[model samples]
Target: MKKIYVTLALSVALLLGSCGNKNNETSNDEAAIAVEVNQTTENQTNALLSVSGKIQSSNSADLSTRMMGYINKVYVNVGDQVKKGQMLVSVNSVDLMAQKAQVDAAIVQATVAFNNAEKDYKRFKNLFADNSASQKEMDDISANYEIAKAQLEAAKQKKNEVNAQLAYTNITAPFSGTITTKYIEVGDMANPGMPLISIEVQDDYEVMAMVPESEISQVEKGTPVDVLVKSINRTVKGKVQEVSTSAKNTGGQFLVKIALEKTDAPILSGMFTTVQFPITQKSDTQMVLVPVDAIIHDGQLSGIYTVSQSNTAILRWLRLGRIFGDQVEVLSGLKADEIYIVSADGKIYNGAKIKY
Candidate 1:
């Protein structure tokens, strides 16, 4: 009886062990990776070409002097608003003033000489006609009158030149604008060609961007673009005002000028900006489309997560084309009606079980 009881216990123990192992295997098989997925579709959309640039005033100038002198006074500060022809700076003009005085004295002397010569010439002409003066005397008087007249004209021209130089001693605004930069101060020695101040027209602004040679052909004058001023955190509409025919000397990139629409918001020059150029390329065949978020970077190559027919996750490498807003055009390595992983809360890999 004891042997029979021991045999029954051994059989029951073996059966329990087998059942536990089978349950563990079933649990492992049921485990799957959970991720949100979407099916790609074909579409025709205008591709957006994004290029970075800087905000600049459509009318900006680096105000400088043409004559060298010590700065006597700066009437405007960095933020001063000035009108066209308004005096902004005054250089040391004592020397210029003295020079003008000398010119004035010379001009006065020449005027007096000219008057005397004219009177004498008239008198001599009358005397010669009346036979009171000889022909030799009239010729000599005429030559003296002509010489005095020439000297008087030359003196007047010299005075005018002196006055023009005197005007330069007082620098004036070329246009109505706000002073953005002040490089010269009182008592600073300023030289010709040295920038003294900078001004920008407050109401006029534009964005300047560089485009590569390959993309320059797509950008055309009058094409509308979207400009984003990151500093202001605002997006504005702009039009292509000008496109350079030749490439830049340094980078070989072509320059593109975009004129922004007038806005009440304060848009200053030299602010960083991003410009989005809309370019459309027609194709005989449709292209596959996927959200920009769906694409992943794999160190020099672009790829996306795709689902296999068996509902397993697989990483697919793709050749991408133009980008359109949130969607990107897929040139190859993907097809229409294909299921792709859009979002995953957990780590995923190739051959990983995907749960819908």
Candidate 2:
């Protein structure tokens, strides 16, 4: 009986040990399979991008005058709209009035002198014809008459100068715009070449952006750009209206003018803005259909992975097209409906059998 019990215990111990070993092996195999599955399905992705830019006016003017005088009345105040050639300020007429009066008196004096000289010349001509006056006497009278006529012409010129100065007393707008500044008040003395107000035309606006020479080939007239101003939370779009033929202050960047699409929103002039421009564009359909991974770059060459019929990942050369955000278009060497591997931790390689 002792011999039979010992044998039976030994058999039971061996069977349990074998069963435990099998279970441990099975669990490790299941875990390994799960990890492989997760690795093949993961992929990084890219999406569409939008451009950014600002708003600006094309016309502006500083109100000024050439003649100095007192301001009689300011016809337009700050924020007042004015048309081209419309009156803006009126100067005091005291000095201008005096000038006009002096010219008028001189004209009267010149006219009387001219009339007397004409009568004397007629008398001299008659006397010379009758030999009652000598040639020298007639010549002297002719010279006096010419002097009086010259004086009369000078008086007319003086009157014209006074009238011109009078016109300068009234200031007017040179272009259509709203008055953005008012530096003078009623009865303020105005000085020549001094600013009185500022007028800015808001109907036409333009945004200026500097584009680097490296990207000049991609920039052209009518290219769209976007602008954002946080002050008013104003977002606007604009187009490239001008591109400088010569470089600007930047090492090799050129000034580009983008005309904004007008808006009814109140946008203050000279507001600081953030702008963005797109160097290239990709279609939505092409970006959505392409794979996110398999892109590789070495030196100047860029390409991606391609799979053979046996599902082998091959490092094939490819030409890249437009880059839209995280996505890039393959211009050549990649066909539609093809499968490529995406990296999880950026560690991926050709001939790597990722069971997808």
Candidate 3:
């Protein structure tokens, strides 16, 4: 009976020892979690935005001709600098010459007719005074004289019109520019209203960008602008010369023009560009911005997690402003020198542990 009592006492003591070990394990886990929460985290950020456009100028023209003729001389080749009123191309003058000849012949015929009528009028005047011509005959002769004089004037006017058409056969540059294209060879037919060449004046250059209508309010005429040429990776400063009053019907964008301050720019037309304007909102000019993925939102509250030293995350509340591209301006929550977490899988929490 004493042995049985001894065995029961040992079993009860063993049960108590097991419960104490389990309690110790649970307390250790709770302490580990507290230590993880205390570790501090950091985030570093940058400001970024995405906008694109093309470079252009206010003076570009598709030159054409007014008369149909064979191109006789192409004085200016592509890339040749021309002065205003410089003859660019000349058409064959043979047709114009023939038209002028026909006009001259008509003028001569009209002159001869006028002379014959005047001689007859003089002869009739002497006959009428001698009473050898009737009153009706004198009136008829004068009427014929007037008709001949009228026909001569009409022929002279036609000659002037032909001469004007002849001058149009020579195509001249309306403004000083470098010819970017020459569509016809020396022998090609010059058709009226067909583009002969494409030219762009060099002195005036501007960048063309399609900005959203919402941003138009921030830009105004004479407002300063910065144009970044993507082709050359160079930046040029300019001013906003024009802002479209109404939004485009198709895309709801407004056309913005940034007239560059003249440089010795070897920059050519039609390069892709980006124009940046100083927006009134501070977010638009924030120095430190971070990817949107780095920011977390709760109701109206904003925050980001800096991976704690213990490999867990501590949510830090933030004040955010304008959003550009995939980046957000961190108005308050982040420091420029710290590092923040960006997730690929998208599952993250205020206190979630992170590996990287």
Query: TM-score for each prediction?
Result: 0.76, 0.54, 0.61
Q: Name the TM-score of candidate 1.
A: 0.76
Any idea what lDDT model 1 has? 0.86
- For model 2, the superposed segments whose C-alpha errors exceed 4 Å read 1-56, 118-142, 212-237, 246-253, 274-356
lDDT of 3 by residue, 1-356 (tens): 99999999999999999999999977755433222112222323332233566777679888887899898988988899998899988888897798899989999999999999999999999999999999999999999999999999999999888878877888888889899999999999988899988888877788888777656677789977677787787888888888888774638888877888888756788888877666554444435567776677899998877766776767889897655555666778677766666652445676764554
TM-score of decoy 3? 0.61
Question: What is the Cα root-mean-square deviation between model 2 and the actual structure?
Answer: 10.7
C-alpha RMSD for every candidate: 4.4, 10.7, 9.8
lDDT of 1 by residue, 60-120 (tens): 8997777789999999998889999999988887887888898888889988998999999
Candidate 3 regions exceeding 4 Å error are 1-51, 112-150, 248-250, 282-356
lDDT of each: 0.86, 0.72, 0.77
lDDT winner, 1 or 3: 1
lDDT minimum window of 10 residues, candidate 1 = 321-330
Residue pairs of candidate 1 with colliding backbone atoms: none
